[model samples]
Target: MGETPWDKGYASPPLGEFLTKWGVTGRVLVPGCGTGHDVRLLAGKGADVVGMDIAQSAIFRAEAFPAVSRECYVLSDFLDLAASYRATFDWVVEHTCLCALDPSERSAYVDSVCAALKPKASFLAIFFREVSDYSGTGPPHPISREEIDLLFGPHFECVQSFIPTQTYPSRPVGSEEVCWMRML
Candidate 1:
């Protein structure tokens, strides 16, 4: 299979910076964790982190990471895997997953994310934004604050939601970025 363009070779800087500031030492998860870069980052900082991806190729590559060798990577879709471990994580990190799905599926994605976390768990997400076509069909979707409000605000309280100063490394030119934290 051809490579997924979204699997850039480094950790997402915005998410990484947030994890550094927020501290992820307890049970943590990285969903849609292509190549497991952020997974390694969280585990390196002492979180008992697990990474899950829908793509077998991504998981195969992820399993070779030292962190995955420690049993931190799973080959599964984030939405479908929770029944295998109930209320299992204190925190969930959503990188570029939601926007990748069709807008029709976003509600289900939100529901699935909510179901995967422990009660009162925290969720952190980062998005790449540019007023462009790629944003409309993307793993790096461009979402405005309004979209976030419509999608997540009614169900989760905002911990923080703001434009990010730095974009993810290797992100396409002309992409803007936003990061949000919501408490369940």
Candidate 2:
């Protein structure tokens, strides 16, 4: 796989705000962390953050970034993380990862997240609610509240869900939903 155009130089505004409000300060996992912007943010906030990406180039680029140089970057498939990682993370921060996966793999994504998080650990995510065009082909596949509920509801409890005022340029004003959930 090649580098994605979605690899932004900075973390998304919603992610920044989430970190500010939540004060994530323990072991954290950032799956599909392309370029590690989010991982850097979490690590800067005193969390032991591990940024994981399937692409070796992405992990290399993430580790090369001066902002995240001290942070850990792993080249591994999120869906098949090491067994030792199970129930190890205090929090999981997701940005574009869920939307980037094929819709068919969403259940697996949720399972992977559940396996990685500690009991009652928080899962903070910014989901892309709408796509500019719905032609069905996308790295950023469109998602909805119903879909989120269906995928994560069984294993996690929805703590909060709201439309974020701040978002990346690629997403529209109301196209993103910031959801906070806790593993059950």
Candidate 3:
């Protein structure tokens, strides 16, 4: 795939706001972190962070993140994490990653994230809402709130959700919103 249109230049606003309130400066993981923008932002706030993506080029771009430690960025499929890293993070923050996957894969996504968290650790996931198209062919395959609730409710607690006054500058105007949940 050529440049993912989802790779807009900065950390997502609603997510960024959530992180700020949630606190940085601890073990954190950003899975499917395209271009590592949010990882950079998290690290800037003193978070000890890892940014993982399936693309080597994306990993290369992420490795340049000033705040991520030298070994922090890894090129790996989120579904298959090594044993040593299991339950290793205080938080796992998902941007557009889960939404980008086929809906059938959402449970595995939830499992992988759960396995990666420390006991009682939390996860923060952002979903895009209000799409007009729904044959579900998109890499961005949009998700409804009910689907989100069902998939994550068993393992996590809904924390907060809100619509944004702003979105990634490159994305279509008013095309997305953000919701965050914490691990139970």
Candidate 4:
């Protein structure tokens, strides 16, 4: 395959910074983890991380990298996670996963994340709060605070939420948000 527009070739800078302070451990799940960049980040922090992606090529590419710990890559749909993964993860780290889901599938995505985490487990995510799309149609969908509250507030308690000062070079400052939510 040719160059992917979204491929960062490394773990997200914000994620790396967060993990540095998070002291991550236990089982972590990364849905829509292309090439396992973020997956390896948590693994290096001593967490047993699993990276799940729908693309076989992504998994193949991830496996080609030198693993830091018990990190594993799997080819599977995040929307239809395996039974073994149900309520098994202590953390579900989201980067671009949320924006990739269609608006209609957002509920399903939320359900899947709830199912994937143990009770009271944390779900940490960096979401696109605003994008350049005029029609509001996108894989990189922009989400607002009200929409997040409407979608996740019922099932989770917000531990922390903030707008990052540092973001990807292409993204405008304050266009991204990070939320640390715990399962109810």
Q: Which prediction has the highest lDDT against the true structure?
A: 4
Question: Which model, 1 or 4, shows the larger TM-score?
Answer: 4
What TM-score does candidate 1 reach? Answer: 0.84
Question: Candidate 1 lDDT, tens digit per residue, 28-108?
Answer: 878888788888877777778888888887888988776532337788776676586557778888877776776777778
- Local distance difference test scores for all models: 0.71, 0.85, 0.77, 0.87
Q: How accurate is candidate 3 locally (lDDT)?
A: 0.77
Top candidate (TM-score): 4
How well is each residue in 1-184 modelled by candidate 3, as lDDT tens digits? 2566677767887677666566755798999988888888877778788888998988877666565442378888998887867999988888888877888888999899999998888787667765656566777778777887888889887667776665665455456656666778
- TM per candidate comes to 0.84, 0.94, 0.87, 0.94
Give the clash count for model 3: 0
Quote the lDDT for 114 in model 3.
92
Regions of model 1 farther than 4 Å from truth: 68-71, 131-140, 169-180
Q: What value does the lDDT take at residue 182 in candidate 2? A: 93
Model 1 is weakest, by summed lDDT over 10 consecutive residues, at 172-181
List, residue by residue over 28-121, the lDDT tens digit for candidate 4: 9999999988999888888999999999988999999997989999899999988999999999999998898888889999999999999999
Q: What would the TM-score be for candidate 2 when compared with the true structure?
A: 0.94
lDDT of 2 at 35: 88
